[model samples]
Target: MQIVDRIRETFRENAAMLREIENKADAFFGKKNLQTSLMQSITMLTTRWVKMPVTP
Candidate 1:
């Protein structure tokens, strides 16, 4: 279960950073072009993460 715990910890850290990113993204929400760019980046990361099998 160590790997699972480690992955959970990693996700927790990412979640914390996402709070700040939320504020940053909010600042660019009104700009459609920038919003797309930010969303694309986020999507790319999430996609990569989802592909990894969480194992212990």
Candidate 2:
């Protein structure tokens, strides 16, 4: 019975750790996606600016 309790405790700890890791991964990817979107927008704006004729 003691060993069973220990095993259960270990599983709970592992599950908690897994959840924390998944949350961090989600946050990291979310930031990465936002950065990529911003970069794409900047690139598009620069391309448009380059194609526009300059007026004095």
Candidate 3:
């Protein structure tokens, strides 16, 4: 359970980090490009998480 809790915490932190990244990207790339890039990044992250092996 501890491992599961830790993974959840990490994901929460990543969510916050992704928001921060989106802010910076919005400023740098503008909304349209940011949406596409951020969506791709999120898709890749989700795919990786789906493929990850977890034992608990």
Task: Find the candidate with the highest lDDT and give its number.
Answer: 3
Q: Can you give the TM-score per candidate against the true fold?
A: 0.42, 0.53, 0.53
Global lDDT of each candidate? 0.88, 0.90, 0.95
Which tens-of-lDDT digit does each residue in 2-53 have in candidate 1? Answer: 9999999999999999987877877767557677888999999999999999
Off by over 4 Å in 2: 31-56
Model 2, 1-56: lDDT tens digits are 99999999999999999999878876977867867988999999999999999999
**Lowest summed lDDT window (length 10), candidate 3:** 29-38
RMSD of each: 12.7, 12.7, 12.0
Error of model 1, residue 37, in angstroms? 12
lDDT (10s digit) by residue, model 3, range 1-56:
99999999999999999999988988899999878888999999999999999999
lDDT score for residue 3 of model 1: 100
Worst 10 residues of 2 by lDDT: 25-34
Return the candidate ranking by lDDT, descending.
3, 2, 1
- Score candidate 1 by TM-score against the native: 0.42
